[model samples]
Target: MDPTLFSSIDFYQLAKREKNAQKRIRLLALAHVKEGKPRDEIAESLKVSRSSVNNWVRRFRCDGLEGIGNKQRSGRPVYLQPQQEELLRNFIESHKLSSDLPPLKGKDIHAFLKHYFDIDYDISHVYRLLKKLKITL
Candidate 1:
């Protein structure tokens, strides 16, 4: 790869200011690249693989510093559709208002899901859903 660096940004200053460790390393790598360091040397000195260094450099070439930061991952898909989620949220609210019972636990929510929606979520995922929906406890 050609020794390429963006002239517009001061990567060393960015590296010094960066709080995230991985981002700091990426900025350091860019600073090295700006000083004409070899990819192998950047990788070795940065304790990352040469392929990783090359990937960062390629990203930098394409989109400057913003490209080298972590890309947002498409995490696991939602189990329920938006309408279904709205239904669930509304159900919980009405249930809470009408009933004198304590806050619903994960298993109660699990039972509701299985009985109403015919969806069987893992217990952990039931809690995750609760957290995602901002349903307290």
Candidate 2:
């Protein structure tokens, strides 16, 4: 077995506190390595590539536990800001309360967004946004 890269106790604490399952497993693998287990054995048991194990160890050595967790990803930005969403929610709620207004559909919401906010979103995305806002069908 190679010399332990990190203290077993530190890795154990990190594994226990980690919320992400993949990161937790990586931490446990490091702990196993610190316990004098071979890299191949750790990789086999963890069902990950030996290279992955090596990378995890390298990251831990360089950046501590934080390096093993998921990196921040930049998803598509929200078209509507929070205030705009709140306004949309209020509009929907007020329309829902009025008996004269017909049941609002995704197209209706999309139209409203386009007319008022100058935001053009697909009907499916509008429905998804409505769902997120807790607007019922």
User: After superposition, which runs of candidate 1 have C-alpha atoms over 4 Å from their true positions?
Assistant: 1-5, 99-103
Candidate 1, TM-score vs. the true structure? Answer: 0.81
Give the Å error, residue 53, model 1.
0.9
- Candidate 1, after superposition: displacement of residue 15 in Å? 0.2
Backbone clashes in model 2, listed as residue pairs: none
Q: Write the per-residue lDDT of candidate 2 for residues 1-137, one digit (tens) a residue.
A: 22343653477887788788999999899888887899999999999999999999888788776778888899999889999998998998899899998989888888999999999998889988888888785
**Cα displacement (Å) at residue 123, model 2:** 2.6
Q: Which candidate comes out best when scored by TM-score?
A: 1
lDDT of 2 at 13: 87
> Which digits, one per residue and each the tens of the lDDT, describe model 1 over residues 11-113?
8899889989998999899889888989899999989999998898789888877888888999987779889888889878887887677777788889989
- Full-model lDDT for every candidate: 0.85, 0.86
